[model samples]
Target chain A: MTTLVSEAIRAPYDFLAWLVGLWSDALYAVGDALGIGMLEYVFMHHAFLVGTLIAVMAPLVGTFLVHRQMALIGDALAHTAFAGVAVGLFVNSILGTGISPYLTAVVVAMLAALAIELISEVTDAYNDVSMAIVLSTGFALGAVLISVNTGGLAVGINQYLFGNLATVSRENAVLLVVLFLLVSVVVTVTYKQLLYVTFDETAARVAGIDVTWYNRLMTTLTALVVVGAMQIMGVILVAAMLVVPVAAAAQVARGFRESLLASVVLAQIAVLVGITLSYRYEATAGGTIVLVAVAVYIGMVLAGKLQSRRGVSEEAGTGSVAREIDAGTGESTDD
Target chain B: MSLEGIPSVGVGGVETSRESAEAGEGRRGEGTADADRVVDAVDLTFGYAAAPVVESVSFGVDRGEYVGIVGPNGSGKSTLLRLVLGLHEPDSGHARLLGHPSLAFAERERVGYVAQDVTENTKRMPITVAEVVLMGRFPHAGFGRVTETDREHAREALRTVGIERLADRKITALSGGQRQRAYIARALAGEAELLVLDEPTVGVDAESVDAFFDLLADLNDEGMTILLVEHDIGAVLERASRVICLNREVYFDGSPAAFAGSDALERAYGTNLGLGAKTETDSRGDGS
Candidate 1:
């Protein structure tokens, strides 16, 4: 059985290697032809599965981040993650020790998230501004560290800058699958609590729902989902996943629950399609997925506008969509 | 859980309200001022700042009293409820539920508070009507899997507010009046002795507003003492038994009849009291 399994693993590699070699050559030709593909095209040595998974989960997670009004925070945390990965790699290389750079990245990402929260609380300024400042400062710190330790691939950190699915690894794929499951389960179990707090924080508080802890928990989860699994996708557009799907879902969904479900479904579909297209055309998966999600959002807006010819949406758009549904249905929303 | 078996914990509790309501009912037989101490506040001077929203606002609400808190928009009537619920610390003076200090945390079990705006956080996730109501049981939703008794209480709370069908509906989807009912149901689930709602009828249709007032009246009849902070002075003059006015200080605390029978309230409100309106106010002010 051991020999059979060993043979099974060895046999697939012959064809896999051939396909990869040909695929890499075609990618080089395409990049050369396009005149826009960056220098990182040489390492067509990535896991397609990992890139696809990242494409799917990033936006799915991004939806919650956007809803929670944490997009800029996401961007900042991704930058901080670079520092974490670099530091971890630096330590491992210097000591001739073995440690996972990505796992270390998760710890640093969490600290960055925590720091952002603390800073936001102290500053009381608009959240996105703080996130931007944190992101720039974090990346600067990472750059300094990279400069201090110029042994390996700092210049080749285009995956962190301009994403390349061709460089995603097996570890990245495993991490992503785990993070996705964690996010999915947490969301499902606390779905109602999240909904209540989101819709009416004050009422939830009055009703004795602890809004503070849940808010922190959600951010913590998003940080984990982002940094733990980001190797599959890259930092160039991590916030896209957190924002685009929900933005699109909100455009179409009638209510909050519908929005959540729609966002997840839309995100998953967008990622899967983005992956297949990226695979076939050698396009950037993150960019393609975000673009598709935007396309879906536009479609939702058009569909909604087309459905309401009399501009009932315009009227209710001022106050609430609930009233519009009630108006159209003739169901005396007599509250 | 059986209502009887549920040991009252928070100030928003059935036992507390029932006792207070019964005590209020007992006062009707006596018909004397000595028995009118449903909610006793002593030397109360509280607000957001040193200026004080409620200063020397000394007063007592008799059991089963329907008290209306009215004044101009910034008069601090809503602040008074927050003080009562112990959500805010009073700068000075003292407020109490029954006989306990206003800051008493456990005393919250007897006080059900509804705010002017019950909006979603817009950042958190959605929760169902049933689950929102069950939040009243936060003190109880522990290792025990929200027992059958807790579910029954939640259901009863919904039925009491006349929104039983909306148990599973999202709070974000309900109409304003229905949403208010859900809020009321949450309070009832807590079994509050004093149900306090700030602007319970604001922005609701007149019919829905009337329905809400009517429900509060029914709760009042069933021995629940209600303290309402409202902008709809017209309906309030008809509903509340005692009226308290605040203008950064206690202006008036008395029966609705005093407002209807005299020119004092008309002058205070800065509106001419029409003859027919006075007659209508008198009829409703003298609670059955």
Candidate 2:
């Protein structure tokens, strides 16, 4: 499946042209289903399944990460997985084996999380220092391992660095579907505990939230999300998979749940639009997706800021009119 | 963690050996230990990264007693308060609250704590004072949707604090004193047996200080035990029944007058309590 994606776009807009053909098939199916239009049901079903997979996965967990301020940490750990992938590839090549990259990436990211937690506690080292150490060492070791191998493991490593979504495989997409549901369920069940930990960690600790355990669990879960998104986002730009969707949602979300829902919606929209347009324009799908997500983020931020400014002026004008009434009544407070 | 054998900092600025201090203090007054001691700290010790900042300490506050803790900067007064509040784990000995090993959330609700600043949350402000105060009910009601009973209690607490009218205002919109009061209301909404406040008077203007203290005094009179960490003892001492002076360790624990005029303060500090900063000849407790 990955091999097909690896070869999907032979030229610019190649995939898009194929999608158009697929769309015609979809129109035919829809027309058959409705007996009215030219669209096909099979195409819509396939698009919906794939679109749903892309939209729901990254952004769901991404919102949680962004709300908790672990977005950059997501990026750091993804790179940290590089060393693991590199090491796995070298061992596989040497042993005449082909280890699953997802398995290797996840294992490395978990190890990185363990190392991060350990460093934060046992030493005076800052979180960024620990992240930096994992990131640089991971990439360096991965490079060293790949340099010794004559195969295209180096090119594979570049997939993580630059994201080659064009080459995503069927089995991997199915794996993504399973993972998307798994993460969503786990997060929902532990929603309150997560928010409590995010809001006031110390208070949560004093409240007996078992903060240390939650910290480790959350980091590991975040790693899992990273590994899942890596197929579409690529390793290099995977942090966006963990951050942008959530950040954009946060700008307008009324609460924690609202933010989560908004992020999922935005991610799906961006993924479909980016993938469709990239195929149309003959551009990199992953790059186009990130660009769209970023534009959405900027728009949300600008709109939110304007709304807040308007609210402030309205408040100021109302404040003075109520001032004399307050004084006369001896309420003496705008509060 | 040397809470057992290390000498505590001298009281009233008096640097003396344990033998001399014990022998010298018996004649001062009768040291009455509380029967219903809620906070029992025995040989308590704490440090940041293992260089002992708070030395061996021992003290007890009875149930429903409003004790004010006063000290100079770097005196570890706030550190001691944190230990009692269960924010920082003590290095050694025992710091118990309500017979528990330390403060727990459900248990801590019995112990309301308001830090100095009480900074409003940075996230979108929850609408209404009723909503803000109901946040204090978090220990009792974990997360997700809030209940009607919670809002009712918050309203009752607001009415108690005489700020029921401000019940609808955003917490960020409240003044410094009003905000502090609202925080108190939040703490009070907990219906806590003991309210631990750290420097509740810092940066509050003189009038606000009087009002804050007056409000605190009124609450204390109504049977809520307040363990406060205050910087300026002048106004607080006027209302405080017992004063606990911490300078890396317990300086003295006794009556307010003995604390103000005694050689314990003169020895631990450099001089007697400097008077004339206020307009009142406040009452003081007998030295023991």
User: Against the true structure, what is each candidate's TM-score?
Assistant: 0.70, 0.77
Candidate 2 lDDT by residue in tens digits, B168-205: 66555555666677777877776778888888766555
All models: lDDT?
A: 0.64, 0.66
Query: What's model 2's overall lDDT?
Result: 0.66
Interface Cα RMSD in Å, per prediction: 7.3, 6.4
Reference contact recovery of candidate 2: 0.06
What TM-score does chain B alone reach in each candidate, compared with the true chain B? 0.79, 0.81
Chain A vs. true chain A, TM-score per model, equals: 0.74, 0.79
What's candidate 2's DockQ score? 0.19
Q: Please tell me which predicted candidate would have the highest DockQ against the true structure.
A: 2
